[model samples]
Target: MSLKILITGAAGFIGSNLCEYFVSMGHDVLGLDNLSTGSLSNIEGLRLKDNFNFLKGDIRDIETCRKAVLNRDYVLHQAALGSVPRSINDPITSNDVNVGGFLNMLVACKDAGVKKMVYAASSSTYGDSKALPKVEERIGKPLSPYAITKYVNELYADVFYKTYGLNTIGLRYFNVFGRRQDPNGAYAAVIPLFTKQLMNKQSPTINGDGTYSRDFTYIDNVIQANEKAMLTVHPEAVNSIFNIAYGERTDLKMLVDLLKMSLSKYDKSILNIEVIYGPVREGDVPHSLASIDKAKRILNYQPQFNLRDGLDEAVDWYWSHL
Candidate 1:
């Protein structure tokens, strides 16, 4: 059955993809984006669709949040100031948008009586933990302002669920990358940034000896997690946070090698480009991997694309678009 959905950050890499997926499934989609970090080009294809409605608004405003949640069956909240480095640069702005804006959305969701709200939680919430595959129950102290904000999101969601009876699900996303992800900005994710540099015959830089690893999840896998979280009828699924990842970790060196190999299919010169090594980033975790057991048991999430599989597609998109 088709549902009425409101997707915050609708012009962003992940949110725009969510908008497209829901619209393609015949759902009525109301997209709200401030376009701060998001680009309209990401959702340009959906602007002409009859079932898709675009609203230029900020989630920080209570009125905007309330308006967006009205009469909506489900709310997929993805708007936030992402990037640990950016948060470190301006912790105040990150707190304002991520924490303050999140509160506004929760209050709006509660008052509007939205059936369910599935938000983009972050794996960075597992800050400083030495565990190999992170589970939901165990977490370490937040290492950065961005991590604090994301962890706060989980706390607020839990409170709203218990105090106000709001149905909320938090999907702690791990290194999500794919088409439409910005490759030009200082805060651009590693995959797209590396792909762009390699495609331009420029060398890509790796921080910290290229040994740092991440559970690089594909965009499609994340979309599936959102969809399942929104539609799940199991009582255990609602009002709970689950890790959305591929259950595998790939180091930076391997990641760059894979990108070069994938892009080499389009341009052979990409294979010869050397990677530069630099200082490790501040507040950056050495390795991140997620235990998807909770998500699988509850949401029945099965990630279809592994790192190499998704990298193949992502590299192709950058080759054509860049």
Candidate 2:
């Protein structure tokens, strides 16, 4: 059956991808974006679809959030200020958007009686924990302001379920990257940023000798997690947090090598591009890997793309678009 869905950050890379996927599946998708970091170009394709509608609004405003949630069957809340560096530089603004805005969305969803909300939680919530293959049950203290905001999201979602009877699921995304991700922003994700630079034959900088690693999940895997979280009928899956990842770690050096090898298919010159070493970034974890057992057992999430496959697809998109 078709449903009415509201995607809070519909103009962003992940949110726009969600809008397109849901719209393609014949759902009535209402996209609300403040355009602070999200670009309209990302969702331009969806604008032409009859099943899609977009509202230019900020999540910080209660009225805007309420308006967006009203009559919506489900809410996929993806609006938040991302990037550790960005949050470190502007903690106040990040707090307002990530923490304040998220609270507003939860209230709106509860008051409007939305069936469920699947929000974009961050892996940064595992901060300072030296554990490998992070499990859903254990988490360490957050290292950055951005991490704190995302951790708070989980707390709020849990309380909403326990107190107000709102059904909510949180997916802790690990280093998500793929097509439509912005490679030009100052705080751009590593994959897209490195891919763009390598394609242009420029030396991309790798912080701290490039030994730091990440789970590096693909965008499709994230989309799959969101869909499963939103539509699943499994009683055990609702109102809990799950790690959405490919369950494998790749170091920065290996990541650059893979990107070069992938892009070299289009232009062999990229293989020879060198990387510059720099100081380690603040708030960066040494390594990150996830135990996707909870998500798989509950949500039936089966990621189709691994690191190499995802990189190839992402490289192709960036080569054509950038």
Candidate 3:
């Protein structure tokens, strides 16, 4: 069955993928973006599609959010300023966009009487805690401005559900990377940034001693989690947050070696590229692993790709495009 869907940040890496996936399913999908961190080219093919429409707008504006979210069946909210370093550099702007804009979207959704809003939450919400496999119910102090905004999102979502009966599901996304993820930004993700550097015969830099590990999730896995969160009929699935990841962890040193191996298929010289180590950036946790048992038991989410499988595909895409 086809449904009306609103995907904010529809021109971004994750948002664009959601837009394309839902559109392919023959749903009436409306995409909203400000083009700040997103690119129109990401959804360029869908530009002429019959059922997909793109609205150039920001969620910071209540009117814009209300206008875009009106009459939507479900909203996949992925728009946000995403990066600890970027947030640290400009905390004010990050707060305005992440917190204020998130509030605007919630209000608009409530007013419009949307069905359910599945938003992009962050794993950084589990800050300062030394837990190995991060559980949903337990969280630590937010280590960065970006983490605080995401945690605040969860709080607002909970209040909206209890106060106004607004149904929501938050997915605390770990390191999500895949095709169409920009590799040139000042805040580009580790995988893409490293892939780009290797493709150009340049070395990739490691922020720490290459010991910092992460639950590197693939974009497709995230999409699967979103769909389940959006469509699940299970009563317990709504008004909850789930950690969306592969349920595995990989250190930076292993991550770089895998990247080199994946890219080596295209260019053998990539295997020779050395990794550079530097001082750890602020607000970075030494290790991050997710307890996907909650997601799997609740949403029945089964991630299809692991780090190795996804990295190969991502390398292939970057090799051809970049």
Candidate 4:
């Protein structure tokens, strides 16, 4: 059955992919974006679908949010200021957009009586914990403004679910990277950044001796989690948070090597590129891995792509676009 779906930040990497997935599946998609960090090009491809509609606006405004939420069945809230370094540079903007804007959307959704709300949470919520595989039940103090904003989203979601009977699910994403992830920004993720450099035969920078590790998730896995969270009829699954990541870890050094190897298939010059190391940026977690057992047990979530396969696809995308 096709349903009306409203996606905030629908021009962003993850959000745009979600819009594409739902629109392709025959859902009526209303894509709202301010294009702050997002690009109109992201959703321009979706215009070919008759069921898709695009709205240009910011989530920080209550009226804009209300207009987008009215009569919407499910709201996939993905708008926010991302990047820890960027947050450190400008915490106020981060708080305003990620926290204040998030609250505005929540209020609008509650008022609209939307059936369910699924949002993009972050692994930065795990903060300074030394745990190898982060679990939802245990979380440490947030180290950065970005982390704080994401944690607050989860808290507010819980309160809305309790106070207004609004169903909400938060997916704490961990280094989600794949096609359409922008590579031009100074704060771009390692995969897209490196893929661009390698394709151009330039050395990629490896922050903090390349030992910093992450459970880099593919976009398809996140899309699967969102779809299941929005469509699942299981009552036990509503109003909770799930770690949306593959249960595997890859260090930055290994990731650079893999990128080179993957790109080598298309361009031989990529194999000769050397990785340069730099001091770690402030607010960066040394290591992160996610426990997906909760999502697996409840949402029946299964990750179809791992690091290597995901890297191959991501490199291919940058190769084509760049």
Clashes of each: 0, 0, 0, 0
The total of clashing pairs for model 3 equals 0
* lDDT at position 5, candidate 1: 99
In candidate 3, residue 204 scores what lDDT? 86
Query: In candidate 1, residue 61 scores what lDDT?
Result: 96
lDDT of 4 by residue, 65-171 (tens): 99999899999999998999999999999999999999999999999999999999999999999998999889999999999999999999999999999899999
**Tell me, what's the RMSD of every candidate?**
0.6, 0.6, 0.6, 0.8
lDDT of 1: 0.95
**TM-score for each candidate, following the candidate numbering:** 0.99, 0.99, 0.99, 0.99
User: Where is model 2 poorest over a 10-residue stretch in terms of lDDT?
Assistant: 193-202
- Against the reference, the lDDT scores of all candidates come to 0.95, 0.94, 0.95, 0.93
- Stretches > 4 Å off in candidate 4: none
Clashing pairs in 4: none
Candidate 1 per-residue C-alpha lDDT over 1-322 given as tens digits, one digit per residue, 9 for 90 to 100 = 8899999999999999999999999999999999899989998999999999999999989999999999999999999999999999999999999999999999999999999999999999999999889999999989999999999999999999999999999999999999889998889899999988988899999998999999999999999999999999998998899999999999999999999899888888888899999999998999999999999999999999999999998987887888
- Against the true structure, candidate 2 has what lDDT? 0.94
